[model samples]
Target: MAKVHAEAQKEQILNAAARLFIEKGFGGASMQEIAEALGMTRTAVYYYFKNKDEILTALVEEVTLRARRLSSRATSEANTDPKEWLRTLVHQHTMLILSHHNEFRVVDRTEQQLPERAYRANEEAKRAVLSNFTAAIEAGVKVGVFRVVDAKVTAFTMIGMCSWPAFWYKPDGPKSAEEIADTIAELAVQSVIRPARRQLKSAGDVSEALALLREDLDHLSLMIEKQPKSG
Candidate 1:
């Protein structure tokens, strides 16, 4: 019980530090600030972490381990559909970003600030995650579900698309993280899937489609103009 409590305290400290690191860059956030945010004495904070870098290292290590585990699980499913694998990857990645927003933001923005050894370790874990995506894409291509393309490039693109939400996602926003994840997962699969050839539309049909698209664009513009801007 004591060990569990200690682990919980350490997690609390890391969460506080992650929030400060997100609000203020790594260089700008101090141990004093983290301690104050958690309502603990600086010495108490030191009990769990020797310094800011140590705290950052812990956060990175935790994220890396989790990513590796998720990647392993994603790839281990026997004969899973490639589209299902992609959906799982995107959903898990999005949920991770949403649940650990501050930690992920800190890692994304302050990666260069980590010690060289720690940075390299994190990169290895990241590569493992990327490899899982690449494997899934290649499998899809082999099964004729996806179009022929560079699997590595497509994996990177899908990762970038999924990771972008960590920067803009809000828990209280109009769309829940699950909804956003669903949309991204659909788009990611669509991006790689082989499209069925269809007969070309006549000029009149194309013109009508374009007019409908214009109306939708106009409606979207008006909606955006009505929304209040943040500072």
Candidate 2:
């Protein structure tokens, strides 16, 4: 129960931080503003986060973690096809940004305020996301499913294309989140999948990989669910 409450409180701080950071850049949103948003004192907010930088750091790490957590499964599983894995990655990422657009904005726009340690941590999380793409690209190339190109560059390009959507996506715009996700998945697959290379592996091979990831996410979701409600 304590763990649950702690998680809820942390989320509360994150939510407040997201709103404040958006309304006011990193400099404009003070601890007092965040506490006031939550009807709490600055000290109380401090108890949860030492300072606004900490909150910003948390917000940035949150997005990176979510990105890594969602894709870890399909990428880690042995013998999974790269292109389909990229499809899953694109789909999950599009939904993630669109669903949590506010937090993602913090992820995309504001990070210079963080200390070197926090910045490195964010970079590490980003690297983890990049590594997954690199691995997927390598796997696809080896399996003859993707073009024999620069895996590192292609991976970076793929990830950049997928992760850059939080800047302009609209929930009520021309396309629903689902439609956008599908399009992203299709484009991602088409771009990377090698032309004339039709040696496709059955989904069953990737199922285990996907399940491995689902397990990780389920664990994460459960951990979040168990957190104490802090309203």
Measured against the true structure, the TM-scores of the candidates, in listed sequence, are 0.79, 0.74
Which segments of model 2 are wrong by more than 4 Å?
Answer: 195-231
Q: Which number leads on lDDT?
A: 1
Off by over 4 Å in 1: 196-231
> Which window of 10 residues has the lowest lDDT sum in candidate 1?
195-204
The total of clashing pairs for model 2 equals 4
Residue-by-residue lDDT tens digits, candidate 2, 115-163: 7887787788788888888887788888788878898898788776776
| Residue-level lDDT tens digits of model 1 in 1-231 | 999999999989988888888778888889999889989999999999999889988998767658778877988973657878888887788777777778888887788988887798889889998999999999888877788889999999988887888788888999988899889988998999876332233234766677878988999999999999966
Query: Which candidate tops TM-score?
Result: 1
Q: What does the lDDT read for residue 108 in candidate 2?
A: 65
RMSD of each: 10.9, 16.5
